[model samples]
Target: MSRTAAQFKLRMPAALRAQVEQAAKEARRSLNAEIVLRLEASFAQVKQEVSQ
Candidate 1:
């Protein structure tokens, strides 16, 4: 298969979507970047918990 960044569709409540958009604007990141950053952080947190 050709190598490329994976793409997927997500559905969220309007309020949540607005919150993410505001955060992305403030952080100077695209909405996709914001979501990826959050996902990475969440996985790191889980790893830390398992290690403890």
Candidate 2:
């Protein structure tokens, strides 16, 4: 299946932003990609909980 990507703005605390950026760099991924991956994982977890 093809997915349509949409741009959205997220506000993060400065400290949290720095942590996320550090993690992204360590993983060799762009910050945007890292955030998307994290969001997808969170959504999956929520869906699983809702289904149970």
Candidate 3:
């Protein structure tokens, strides 16, 4: 799907959280948007690799 909406709990190291938050701020995007964009890109990369 081109769009996604889901709610779930997530747990991660505090350091990782800080890194993501920092990147989000630098990109001028909300924390959630930054994470979603990255996750989508990661999946696309894996799919491409598998197809090759």
Candidate 4:
């Protein structure tokens, strides 16, 4: 399925922002991509838990 991208501002703590930046660099993804990847992983974990 095709999806449209939406843009919004997210306010986060400086420490958390730094952590994400480091992880993004390590993962070789853009900051937005890193955030999306992490969110998808989190949702998958919840779905797996619910199914058990």
Checking candidate 2 for backbone clashes, the offending pairs are none
Error of 3 at 39 (Å): 0.5
Extract clashing residue pairs from model 1.
Answer: none
Please give the CA lDDT of all the candidate structures: 0.90, 0.88, 0.90, 0.90
What local lDDT does model 2 show for residue 10?
Answer: 86
Question: What ranges in model 2 sit over 4 Å off?
Answer: 1-4
Candidate 3, superposed: residue stretches over 4 Å from native: 1-4
How high a TM-score does candidate 1 get?
0.89
Deviation (Å) of 2 in candidate 4: 9.7
Model 4 residue runs over 4 Å out of place are: 1-4
Candidate 4 global lDDT:
0.90
Count the clashes in each prediction: 0, 0, 0, 0
Better of 1 and 3 by TM-score: 1
| Tens-place lDDT digits, model 1, residues 1-52 | 2238888789999999999999999999989889889989999999999999
Lowest summed lDDT over 10 consecutive residues: which window, candidate 2?
A: 1-10
| Candidate 4: tens digits of C-alpha lDDT, residues 1-52 | 1147777899999999999999999999988888999999999999999999
Ranking by TM-score: 4, 1, 3, 2
Q: What are the C-alpha RMSDs, in order, of all predicted structures?
A: 3.2, 3.2, 2.9, 2.6
